[model samples]
Target: MSYEFERESLENADDRIVAGRAADGDTVAFAVLVRRYTPMMRAYARRILSGSADVDDVLQDAFITAWEQLAQLQDPGQTKSWLMRITSRKAIDRVRVSRSYTDLTEMELPAPERIAPPRQAEANAGVAALNEALLALPDAQRECWVLREFGGYTYEEIAEQLDVSVSTVRGLLARARKDIIVRMEDWR
Candidate 1:
């Protein structure tokens, strides 16, 4: 088969088929998986890490780990979730390692000067308010909220990923929701 035909076929295939092909040593299938999941993985990492600085590195590491470990995946159908779990773990590890040092350079201010239309300005304000609220959350609660709300992991899945009890995940999410609600209300 021609390379374009093969690539198109892989692109149209479902996750299970693509994952199985990847496990069978097809780099094209793996690349397809990477293209499909990279955005979601980046977003998840950004939320969990609460910044963009290390998000790409964490995601790249997760993809490398996924490539090495793909054969161990018992269900090809669950590939997306598996990738997300890898991303969440890597992001958490980055946070843990970086907790020891405060980067003074990161504290520097950025050059800012653009103004938007009224509608865009209002939307941007809401988004900024939401981001501030998220940043104010405790790390554990933030992780739980991101994993559940952004990463789309179930409570049991989050508990396993976080190495915490399900009840703890619930409590953390509840507290996160309450705090975010109060913070957002103040923004109005």
Candidate 2:
């Protein structure tokens, strides 16, 4: 089948089918996966990188890596988490190379979606405050929090990514949560 026809057909296919095709070197199937997951993967990378300016770069690198390694994926059904893991690694790798997080004295929050009415004004304030507090956290604490909360990674997964013990991941998350809560008390 032509790539265009295959792409169209796969648009509504289950992730497993799309992933299976992609693994078999079907570029159209891979593009479908890309279109399906890019927004979420972008958001995951952005949160992990703490609104870094390199979000697009990270995403590009991640897609390249995913396309290259899709065949090695053991279970096509698990494609989403696999992509997320790649994105998280790509994001963390960027952080490590730049060491930018250690020096993030202030970070511009990724803009919030505009609400239609002023009634939700306080919601924006809460988001702003949370972003500020997250920026203020120690690098380890922030990584743990973002990976678990934003990435939806398991504690063991976070530990493996961060190269810390699960206990350490738990501790970091706790401290990060406490610090955020303290910082956001005014929003409450």
Candidate 3:
């Protein structure tokens, strides 16, 4: 198994034991559980945060929420997925909250002084065009594409994360690929 899976498996076992102890009023055991899961949770939060600086705050809130609600979790084996769902929701919420506070004018600054050679500049322009095309896609299609491309998630995993069917994930991927091909053709 990959490191992520191995860590997740270990986390599940640890969570079960720690949660049992925590429920019995062992604060030290609870702390141990939080410590064990913190790294994985922060890594996932960072991935979702991308360039955001508010990830630490988001993760703190998520962990607190998870701790308060752990008693309600029926299956200890799925702790990682549960934590991830919480983290993703919190990270998205942070983005939404921060967007309103950001200055749009600052984003319009002129390009940096250092310039690449003509060929490199052309390649950069191509990448910019591709990103623009991705931005033009519908939210659902774009999300499916990003999860597959950036997260390395399989169709089944994407489907599970998005709460959709595997066939729906496949259709979204097909449509996203077709859209990219058409956009690249026009760009060329």
- The whole-model lDDT of each prediction reads 0.83, 0.84, 0.68
Which is superior by lDDT, 1 or 3? 1
- Which ten residues in a row are the worst by lDDT in model 1? 100-109
What would the per-residue lDDT of candidate 1 be over residues 1-188, giving only the tens digit for each residue?
A: 99999999999999999999999989999999999999989877776666548989998999999999999999999998899899989988887787522221233223346645775667666767777787788888877886787668899999999999999999999999999999999666
* 65-86 per-residue lDDT for model 3 (tens digits): 8778888878766776777777
Alpha-carbon lDDT of model 3: 0.68
Candidate 1: what lDDT? 0.83
Compared with the true structure, model 1 gives a TM-score of: 0.74
Which segments of candidate 1 are over 4 A away from where they belong? 100-136, 180-188
Candidate with better TM-score, 1 vs 2: 2
By TM-score, rank the candidates, best first.
2, 1, 3
Steric collisions counted per model: 0, 0, 0
Q: Candidate 3, residue 94: CA error in Å?
A: 4.7
